[model samples]
Target: MNKSRFWVVGGEYTSTDFETLIQGTERVVGPFETRGDAERTWRVLSEDHRPQAQVRFTIAHEHLTMNA
Candidate 1:
């Protein structure tokens, strides 16, 4: 079986183009059990940094194998 995990990734980028992130400004939120949880965190992060035009955040997900 496989389980899905969610995370929030991204941070302040070097420019508005978002090609590269500024060193030391990268942020990785977590491996949330559900996408909804991850989204909630994402919203907070986005809103908190909304004033910064270069700051951004997005939700990401990955599947993990579960052993029985």
Candidate 2:
């Protein structure tokens, strides 16, 4: 079976603060081999936390195509 995983990390404070931010989101998908890998993935998706900002949310997506 094929599976997908997602990790999100965001905080206006510091990287460590992202841990608390994760608690309010969906449960993290597993099969993560190492904490460093997981952290790296999360950092990629993380955004700055701005509660009072006019634009409170942001979304980003990317597609990669490779030739064999």
Candidate 3:
């Protein structure tokens, strides 16, 4: 099985909002300081989380990704 990772940009959302966005669908990969930071973190997580079939998203970016 393989998973996927994504980073969101240009959005205004709180941590709770991000959590809700990814609720029950994926694992939050981080609480990044900024969208750019989340993007960088997503790259690292893509390698590890992708193989495990665990959806990964960044709370900072307010984006979600599921296995695909």
Q: Which candidate is the best by TM-score?
A: 1
Please report, as a residue range, the 10-residue window in candidate 1 with the lowest summed lDDT. 55-64
Please, what are the lDDT tens digits per residue for candidate 3 over residues 4-66? 333432222234333333334444554554666777766666555554433444434344445
Enumerate clash totals for all models, in the order shown.
Answer: 0, 0, 0
Best-fitting candidate, scored by lDDT: 1
Which stretches of candidate 1 lie above 4 Å from their native place?
A: none
Ranking by lDDT: 1, 3, 2
Q: Which ten residues in a row have the lowest lDDT in candidate 3?
A: 8-17
On residues 3-54, what C-alpha lDDT tens digit does candidate 1 reach at each position? 9999899999989998899999999989999999999999999999999999
The list of candidate 2 runs beyond 4 A from truth reads: 1-27, 48-68
How accurate locally, in lDDT, is each candidate?
0.93, 0.38, 0.46
lDDT for predicted candidate 3 compared with the true structure: 0.46
- Model 3, position 46, has a per-residue lDDT of 58
lDDT of 2: 0.38
